[model samples]
Target: MITVPQLDQYKDLIGEDQLSQIYDKVRALSGLHVMHFNTTERGGGVAEILQSLLPLLEDLGIKHTWKVVPLDDTSNHFTAHLVDMLQGNIPGQLEAEDQQAFLDTLAQTPILSRPQDSQADLYFVHDFQLAPLTTLFPWLRPAIWFCHIDTANPNQYAKEYILRFLNNYNVCAFNSQASVFKELPREHVQVITLGIDPFKNKNKYITREQGMQAIARCGVDPTRPLITQVSRFGRWKNPWQVVDIYRLVKQHIPNVQVALVGAMEAADDIEANDVLADLRKYAKGDPDIHLLHDPTMIRDQEVNAFQRYSSVILQRSSREGFGLTATEAMWKEQPVIGTSSTGLRSQIIHEQTGYIVDDTQTSADYTLKLLQDRDLWRKLGQQAHEHVRKNFLFPMIVLGYLDALTKAMAFAHAQPNLSGGQKR
Candidate 1:
């Protein structure tokens, strides 16, 4: 079992007054039980958020349970395609066979038995993978469909299919307003940005020397300025463009090295291997261009080291959900150069928090500036860290969830026919 530090432990970082306010909100949510459902228990942003959030919820005296729907080879392939369609990569209806496979897979999962055993007040169905759970289990009242993806321009068919399940939820939460579909009721929508645990292995405090040593173990020269982008190998993350940006940066700074870090084991992301293979081919044996995705080599400690020691971090995603990588870097007082994706826009304040660029040229330009100008880098890094501390930390996110749950419960109570908690 994974243990999360107690809420009180964050008192110093979040301030005593703010922590007290969080407890007040917890009082309002007294007796509430939240059930979270997703495709996998590890990898990806959703799992990371839940891993921290759920344990904290337990510590707060809230009843909660997490369940992962089992995915076989067939279902995994179908759902991966489904994710692409939802993200607007595939702009058509899911094939009939694929839809059937998705449904069949869900039907076999033991999650169906969970509704009977667990008396959850709210069902928090994450992303499109398990959105249909609201419909599959009619008793799941006051459910919140928390979507952590770039759904600003999802495929029409995918949008319609997802809406069918979303309509059943009490609230539809998104990382940004841009991700919310127009079809969803205005009242049903809630924009709750994702957050990072400051004390987690990936974001915890480490000395500069320790950071340097950790990166050196991974073959990264500690002396050279490192430009890193840590995210999963998703097409939307724009891993290829990161390589382009690196090459552009290397043009001016000969000693500069770029590390493209990503997780390759996300079950829903079947395209990771393909994208990584293509990235390797594109790099063409550039000695400075480090493509670090081996889980054994680049775990949380190494990521923490890279972010802490790097001159600048890049989150040049084409369409990011919330860019937790940027948030992580920001929390570590590392300046990030991100694209104008909605999520990045929400986290970055342009020149104030961090720089936001449109293309590889601008991204490269910003990277060069941050590397060359030490004072500018420190200014942005300090501002970025403060911004994350105020807005993107885990305690703030818990407050957001508590507020959303309070509103959802009220919404459910207002509906004459609807009722929350277990039916049995």
Candidate 2:
């Protein structure tokens, strides 16, 4: 096990008051066990959050376990398409075969129990892959479905298909109030924003020299002002629009350079690759526009270094659940400019923490203003860091989950109509 000092390097943002409060809550629910089930256990935000969260929950004396549910390899094909379509990558209805394949995968994979006889006090399911649990196992322990995706009034086909999976959840939680899927059975919904772990490798402190070295290693000029956008290379992430905005800002600040650093999605969806290809065409060998595709750079350290070195962080996502990268950047005391849709709206405090813009031109204008005014940048960055530490860190998010779970358990016990499925 890593020592406390090492853990502190990542989690030092958790204050003593917050730690005491979590300790009391864990003791209050001493017997309650939390089991989190998701599809991929790596390469995504859900996995990264749970990796740190479950261990901390255990340390605080809460019985918690994280589990990765398995799906047929073939199903990933359809799932990849659905995930893209939902984000507006493609236009078409899911075929009958696509629909059936999803249902089949859900039915074929049984709910797994660890340690022979283990069940959970609360079962949390993430994203679409595990959604079928609602229909297939209505008698299972009262489960809460946690959605990390953008689901604002889902389309007719998606809403209908998702109903089978959602009705099973005792309560549903979304990242922002704006992303509430009002069409779903909304009676038991809650808006719990996603929080960051301040102690994580990406959010930890690095010297100014170290930050500069990391930027230099990426082949970017360490002396020039840098604007960065870190996200998975998906269309919804809007890397091309980032380029458009960077071009606009270049007229005002000729010395400013833009870097789009990102990890590719699982299996590299076809449309995302197409977008990257299209954007590269505009690059035209300009050193000012850098697209980094480094496989060795572990997520936290690289992101932390980039944000630390950046003059301003940019997140131009058009349709986001909550831009976790933006939140992470803000936590590092960096100013951010983002699109005005989805969860990005919640992260920015207008001109206070950062700026929210509706278009590329507006985002560029704000970027220019920040570059021109160093004192304003410092003030916004300081406030943005505190704002994230206060409202959006892991301890608070876990507390929200604890409170919701307690309420859900009470609600479940009162309703005899809802069934807890028999043992596997």
Candidate 3:
């Protein structure tokens, strides 16, 4: 038989009072039919977050359904271009045809058809990819756009279209500061942090022998200082820059081995394979740099094992929604070095938990400093683990969503024509 854990089980970590507060609010969300729509079903931070979150919402007596708004190859090509637009790659204005294609693709997807078919109390759409779908399904109850990307900086045309699409939702959700998602001060934006489950399969405890075995399989040398960056092989993730930083670290600490572990998600990401292949060729001469994929590892749990075995983890995204990999690393008591902007700005507390580096030299300096002094990372690791436990766990994220849904409902109630969802 299948088993679901209790909400009160978190009391030991968060304390009785805190869990009680969560439970109180969670109970209020009972029978709430929540639908979370996103681009991919398996890859990236959004999918992984939903993997833990949707189930917990069900355990809390909320009817939660997670669906992927898939795109065809033709549509996905345009979608990838849209991702570029969000990353500020597209110059000048988006051609009117591309803008229409963006909306038209989402409109044609069958996954979104369920929103109009079923009676969901609230719609929680994730990322900019699915933001336009709300315009086609305003009757799907109160909608909240979960903008997981840095919307503040984008092509002017892309920003204009995104902000216009966002207006369809009653409110928008963000994890970073006001500058990341706020198009205007008047827009109703909910700042909710993304999270990771330390108790999940990847975050669960592993014996030394098992961890060593897993590391050995990844071709990571246990004696050498291991630096790992776990992210999709995307340009925005700055994977090439990460490899360059590792080379810089090698000059200072030659024994250091850098593991770039990534897996292609079933998203509309068209450039993943080309990027991964190019990076593989870029690191062909380096014996110390281990480039791995999910296919050879067999499962994502191995990536977790690599993180647990790592000396330090790197999530240095040039543009990040929120780097969940950094949180996963921190939870494992590993010192994480991430970039200083986007979601990484809020997660890594500079010298407190981990270092935030802007360039290769800065990253190398911090990596060398930590490697030279064992005591610093140990203390930082302890603090990093506590940071995730307190702020970025599954229970806390459930509460964040609850708070967003509450705001969405209130926003809906204020609308005389759009009044359909509950108020609690």
Question: Which candidate's TM-score is highest?
Answer: 1
Per-model CA lDDT versus the true structure: 0.81, 0.73, 0.76
TM-score of decoy 2: 0.87
Ranked candidates (lDDT, high to low): 1, 3, 2
Clashes of each: 0, 6, 0
List where candidate 1 sits over 4 angstroms from the true fold.
1-5, 416-424
Candidate 2, residues 188-239, lDDT tens digits: the string is: 7766667887766787889988888888878889799888999877777888
lDDT top scorer: 1
Give the range of the ten consecutive residues with the poorest summed lDDT in model 3.
Answer: 415-424
lDDT pick, better of 1 and 3: 1
What are the per-residue Cα lDDT tens digits for candidate 3 across 1-424?
1224556567678776666666677766678898888878887778888888887778777898887777777777776777678764468666688768767776777755664565688888887777777677666557887877765467776777777766567777787764454454343667777777767788888877787788887777877788889888888888887788888888888788888888765566788888888988999778987778666573666877888887878887887777888888899998788886677888889898998888888888888888888899899999999998888877767777888787777678785122223332
Query: Which window of ten consecutive residues has the lowest lDDT sum in model 2?
Result: 415-424
lDDT (Cα, tens digit) per residue for candidate 1, span 188-271? 678886788887888889999999998998988989988899998878889888888878888898888888887576777777
